[model samples]
Target: MRKHTGKSVSRRLVLKAAAVGGTALAMPAIVSRSVLASSGEINIMMWSDYLPDPFRDAFTKKTGIKINFTGIGSNDDILNKMKATNGQGFDLISPTLNRSLLWEPLGLIQPFDMKKIPIDKVNPAMAKMGETVWNFGGKGVAWVPHIWGTEGVSWRTDKFKPAGEFPSYGDIWDDANAGKTMGRGHSVMLGAGLALERKGEMAPGSMWAAYQSPEKMTEVWSKLTEYCIGKKKNLKLLWNDADTQKNGLLNEGVIVAQTWDGPPIALKTAGEPVMYRAPVEGAMAWVDGLALPVGVKNVDQVYAFIEACYDAALAGEAIKTHGYNSPVTGADKFAGDVYAKNFADAYPGDALAKLNPWPPEAPWYAEKRTEFVNKFMSA
Candidate 1:
């Protein structure tokens, strides 16, 4: 059986590589924990293969705080699980930066206790992005930046050759690649759809408007739905999980697919002739981070888990095992020479400047996108 790794790439390097900067302030006070029974464990809801096993084991050994992981496949899955449990099942939740914003309005998450987190050790650029973007008008922080990466095309290097530079998201529509390509069945698909719109491959409009206005969302989804239906026959699969996508590429003869940067890197390291591309339109950039769910029972253990994530040694293992870059400063020192070189080559800093980061979308927008996706898949 083949092993499949999960999503995320480093946003810290991308921020530095792009030379972007902004100011941010730390959390003023730690939320007072209400008395509750000690569980001696920190429950984390995150994507599969996100936290390396070695790191989890080491964290437990070092701190005596057991890490209970509930692996999820997508951001929507995270939200669904949280809703099902009324945000009570987990202490720490990981969601993409944009999804984290939605949790605040839903009353599902609470602000981090800055005193417990090593805020000074986090990447300043990421801190700024979180404060300015995810923090709902500076009211309070509900999300803390952790790991990030780009969403782009991954192809079998042994099978397909780009004419020159890497192709655009429109490549998924190529007739010749029919029955050999796959697309993710999630809102990130909207990122690629919007990129196609930008390149004039689909109807033109403000992609952001789809997230803000019902009329505009209908307009965008109408175009997106039509475009997807046209190419549906070309797709070998519509994947909902990383392992399925990884196995499709490795053993099922899939030639190209939309993917997070991690899978291809893992495949390449394993000697598969695969490559992840930065499409001409732009890679869909994303940041997934830690958030405290409301009514968490083990508050101190939660802080221990957060600090363990930032431990340079553990951060290094995450990069080596998961193909993601840690947002914690100096974690790269532990990523080792070979993986570091591979990461530098795979995601050059200048190329990162071309990445289009995922922004917060309205709940209605997400609802409409899911509706269209279900329809497209069933069709």
Candidate 2:
């Protein structure tokens, strides 16, 4: 299994490793004696590079709260760790909206205490979306919107050319790109499955509805699995991490693959002829946010950390470093000209409006999705 801040591994392998307590799970870094002795330390489990170091330092300087960071490779890592500890290990976690649907119901995380943070500073639309997804069963607010991004197609313009306006998910099936394409081996597969259905290449099915009923799920996965089997020979890889996807495009000569917006933007910034496309079928937009785990020990520090994340300076720094959009309303004002311009260009006004957030899924959805992903991977 892959470590979040390190190498790449398949999602199926990682989940299995996590189940039996694999050593790949990141251990907490040693806290300085001064910070440990202080009453301001907050433990956080999140994607390794999601939060920039300068921002963490600035937050500590501003609030006197030290952040203990533990990075994980996938949402499954977050869920597995929380379950192993019975939600007692970390004070804060960053999970996507869909994964939180599973975590909240299991009592692994508690809802946000609105009064503790400056909720008004966040973008209203983004905040509302977070609330709808996190606040399950009217159980208090589960999380606050932090960073948002899209899952779409990233291709090497120097290697691949589309026959039409721009490439869509269908490019994965193009024979011209045989033995040079990749697909993510997780929930993003669900998004690509839906995209194929929308393009009329596959039979009609609701990717969203598959979450609610076993019958619908079986129907959807049957078509998706068959599609994968047909396309299997063309696929050179099935990636489970951003680094593998980026490296494949940059050095391994992969013509095209499903990817997050950040890597291609980074590659382009570094002079690679890579492009991230909001496909004609629509990009899958997602929000990852801060949430408290059950039995949290540092309430005051947790609130301080949450408040610090909303700071305009921190938000701007996040945008500059990771190519993610901040949910704070005015953070763009603090962003450097180049990054701001790049963000605007990547998500033009019309394109941004067309971005679709992943719909809420039932708890059973993740397990079923994983089962199909494992099947697709083995096929």
Best by lDDT: 1
Tell me the whole-model lDDT of each prediction, alpha carbons only.
0.70, 0.68
Reference-based TM-score, model 1: 0.85
lDDT of 2 by residue, 58-82 (tens): 6676557788999775788888898
Candidate 1 lDDT, 177-243, residue by residue in tens: 8888887875435755766876777665456567678888888778778877877888887777678
The number of the candidate with the highest TM-score is: 1
How far is 127's C-alpha from truth in model 2 (Å)?
2.0
RMSD of each: 7.2, 9.8
Error of 1 at 188 (Å): 6.7
What residue runs in model 1 are displaced by over 4 Å at the alpha carbon?
Answer: 1-13, 16-39, 132-139, 187-195, 203-206, 348-350
* Residue 176 CA displacement from its true place in model 2, Å: 1.5
Which residue pairs clash in candidate 1?
Answer: 9-148, 9-149
